[model samples]
Target: MHINFPLILVIAVAVAGLLALLDLVWLAPRRRRVIAAYQAQVDTPDPQTLERLDKEPLLVEYGKSFFPVLAVVLILRSFLVEPFQIPSGSMKPTLEVGDFILVNKFAYGIRLPVVDTKVFDVGDPQRGDVMVFRYPNEPRINYIKRVIGLPGDHIRYADKQLYVNGEPVPRDLMRTEPDDEVPPGHPLQSLAKVDIYEEYLEDSAHLIRHKRLSQPARPQEWLVPEGHYFMIGDNRDNSNDSRYWQSDQMPRELWGMVPDNYIVGKAFAVWMHWPEPKLSNLPSFSSISLIH
Candidate 1:
């Protein structure tokens, strides 16, 4: 089952805050008064009264210490920055499986947690920016991809080439051999051809992988809708992105553009890349580097 972590955090904060308030406003004062009255009646307090005076309530102690920390985490992650891991090769070369990346939450704007309603507008996503967003098909699941088409822009993918606004994007071939570093049993391992290229986007350039053995989806063009964006994975043939959406397999909600409110953040850096269990002995930092 999918656990809703944000909701859990919110609940934790509320419960902790309530326990702390109860102790501060009523329980602690009442206990102190009772202990003081018992002390006045005898030269030395009884074992029961002494125990009560010395022992701190577990709930109240924990609440008072943990609430502030949890509140700070919630605010920072929701507004400033958040971290994510790449689990697939959809953005290979630029991002790889096992890479832990930090996303700039305020780059696009600040949004309330859980509800994801954008409350501020710092900036809009630019072309070539790597982004994390709620999957259009499932709002609860997050996906990462590069922004290819902005609102009102036209995008076309054909013959393994990308076109934006009637201009063809440029690319330089980097390699043709299958990447030996690809994890064993990975889907890319069985592919006959793996081509890597440095594709130049409107503003920046990044590496992309192409699988020659896989059949290309028919060329398609899309006109991005207002307040929405078009995205595509860097691994062109292997990724199930905006290029191919079958009505039978996907809900109508994923027809084309991703709603603006669905954006999570802009992914900017790769902080770590631990070795996968399948290749534990291999160099863990083979793919460790800053993301473009």
Candidate 2:
């Protein structure tokens, strides 16, 4: 089962803050009065007696200790930035499995965590940005993909080529080579060779890949509705992106479009890569670089 981490964090912060506030307003003053009365009765209270009188309840002590730290984490994660680990090759050649990346939370706009309601309009996603968003069909799950179409934009995918607003997006074949990064036993491994291309989307230039000799995906087209965006993965042939969101559970009209509210943040940089969890394989910082 998926854990709603944001909700949990918010609840923890609230509870901790409440306990601390209760101690400050009521319990702490009462303790102070008791200590003062004891001091009035005795000529000189020993250090041990004072310490015992001033001691806080265990629950209140824990709450005061944890509230500040939790508040800082919530602010940074909900508004500034958050780390994510890539779990699939859907964004291959750009992001690989186990690649840890940082997403700019306010890049698109600042939204209230858990509820996901945008309270400010910082900016809208531009074409060619690598965006992390909630899967429209299942908002609990997050997916990362490149922005392909904006509101009112027309997008077409045919013959493994992409078109935006009726113009063919330029893609130059760089090479056809073996991808050593392809995970073992992956379906794409059967197609040993992969074609690498430099696709230019607007001013952004990024590399994409397609399996050599693999059958082309069926052509598809989408007209992005207002308040929605179209997303596609860089691993053209291997991604489950806007081109193939059709499923029995989703309505036909909402299949290929991601709503604006589903936007999480813009993926800006990859900080590390550890392809597996074995102790022998340590995470490497060599892959640290800004996302194109």
Candidate 3:
């Protein structure tokens, strides 16, 4: 059977902590005084007493040292904020591979740790928010992507243009050239360079390299079912998202259409970029466009 690691951690920490707490709050004083008095009486610990005492300190030590740290992590990751690392180029230009990001735990709603059940009231995701969430297929694993469609939105992707509820979501040609260095692919050699002109997401428009050189016959139209969301990568043509996978093939373990529960939080800003020089040479954070 598959074991859930987070649940195991929580259970282990809880059990170890409760045992330790019992020892400290209820048993320590009494045991210590008894040991002292008995030692005075016998002047030496008997073999059985010595054997029992031998194991107590080790358990006490293990509980004392690790339980608090585990509990703190469980609380912080469960309630307030959690950090994650970007492992792929699925979000390339906006969030490069190796980028570390912070996800607001309470942004969508407060969820109990491990269980993912929402507890309190919270806000919903807007059009352009970059969000992190638990992959519906498996809550143990986390996935991050941009939120593109909401519930009941008749989302359509044809010839590279996004039509939401039949209204063409605006997009513009920013610059056209080989973005080969940008993503290591040759898609730019044939596609149009589209800049996201909306402000619902980032202030500076995110560049979506589209190779839409044709007429799309219902290229992809989806009536975003309830509770699930339509997700896409900043890299445009490169992401494996709602566009490619059919609903039945998508296990409920994956995010259902417009699932408010799958959402974890809205990403706010870039805290740090490494090799530091890349961001250092660029314009100030104020000048950076939060366009898409």
**lDDT of every predicted structure (CA atoms):** 0.83, 0.91, 0.66
Span of ten consecutive residues with least summed lDDT in model 2: 246-255
Give the per-residue lDDT digits (tens) of candidate 2, residues 25-121. Answer: 9999999999999999999888898999999999999999999999999999999999999999989888888999999999988899999999999
Q: Which stretches of candidate 2 lie over 4 Å from their true place?
A: 179-191, 245-254
Model number with the top lDDT = 2
- Model 3 TM-score, all chains together: 0.72
Better of 1 and 3 by lDDT: 1
- Give the per-residue lDDT of model 3 (tens digit) for 235-274: 6766656666535553633343436777777776555444
Candidate 1 residue 247 Cα shift, in angstroms, is 6.6
Q: What are the models' TM-scores?
A: 0.87, 0.94, 0.72
Decreasing TM-score order of the candidates: 2, 1, 3
**Candidate 3, superposed: residue stretches over 4 Å from native:** 1-5, 35-56, 181-205, 211-218, 246-258, 272-292
- Which of candidates 1 and 2 is the stronger one according to TM-score? 2
Instruction: Tell me the tens digit of each residue's lDDT in model 1 across 1-292.
Output: 6677888988898898998889889988888887888788899768976896856688789999999999998888889988887888788768878788899999988898888898988999998999999888777788999899999999988888899998999999998977655578887686666899999996788989887776666788989889998988898776767777636544543446779999999998887785474554543555555567
